[model samples]
Target: MKLTSKGRYAVMALVDLARFDNINPVSLRDISLRQGISLDYLEQIFSKLKKNEIVKSIRGTQGGYVLNKNPNDIKLTNIFNAVDEKVKTVQCRKESKKGCNGKATKCITHNLWDELETHINTFFENKSLKDLLNNNKETRV
Candidate 1:
């Protein structure tokens, strides 16, 4: 699956929020600046995240966005899937007999597509935001 810029920025925004308390929201400006994303774009992406229940928004002087769940409870797959629904690698796929159009068996490398999708799902599902933090240290930042 190919993640669009929206998906990538959404993940980055979430990771930034993960560093702070859930009760405390982070301003869109701050997130945009830190992630090098445009504030307007982050605002749009955040609205979708809020709709998905992946984030909670607050309105006030301290208004901003925060995660709805513990970072550990939020799987990377959730973030990924929330922003990008095109989770399959296969393009123009189909099936015939088993309702399989030209998309599935029509391709000479059907198994490869299936295997790749499975691997991608497995990798993301097993990963969490905490894993990202625990594994990385001394980042360029």
Candidate 2:
């Protein structure tokens, strides 16, 4: 259930957006520098996010990207889906027969792995990026 680099960077990009007080766009170059992501890579990710309505861009001297919705309105799953981040812990986690033995006895811990994966996927699916921000605030004060 590890997040792909795309997903990780996407979240970081959003967090950078969250930090800014103004709806004014933040340059990709600045986000890349602050978040330690590549400009080219951020551009590519932003294309997908923009298409999905997760973000909107403003042009001109103030040009850059901003969230289409408020921070609390965005979900982690929304960001994850924007990048095609799958929740499988292994190929077999999705019923792939590539490496699995047919019998349950052969894969002694198959059920456990499957259950764990289900729980993880469910958690991420239900949780939102907004929840993350709320929790952070709660802990601080």
Model 1, position 4: C-alpha lDDT score: 80
Q: What C-alpha RMSD separates each model from the true structure?
A: 2.9, 3.4
Every candidate's lDDT: 0.77, 0.78
Q: Pick the candidate with the highest TM-score.
A: 1
Worst 10 residues of 2 by lDDT: 97-106
What TM-score does candidate 1 reach? Answer: 0.82
Candidate 2 lDDT by residue in tens digits, 31-70: 9999889999999999999998998888788689888887
**Cα TM-score per model:** 0.82, 0.74
The true-structure Cα RMSD of candidate 1 reads 2.9
Q: Which stretches of candidate 2 lie over 4 Å from their true place?
A: 90-113, 136-141
Cα displacement (Å) at residue 46, model 1: 0.7
Identify the runs in model 1 with alpha carbons over 4 angstroms from their true place.
92-105, 138-141
Top of the candidates by lDDT: 2
Scored against the true structure, residue 132 in model 2 reaches a CA lDDT of 71
Estimate candidate 1's alpha-carbon lDDT, on a 0 to 1 scale.
Answer: 0.77
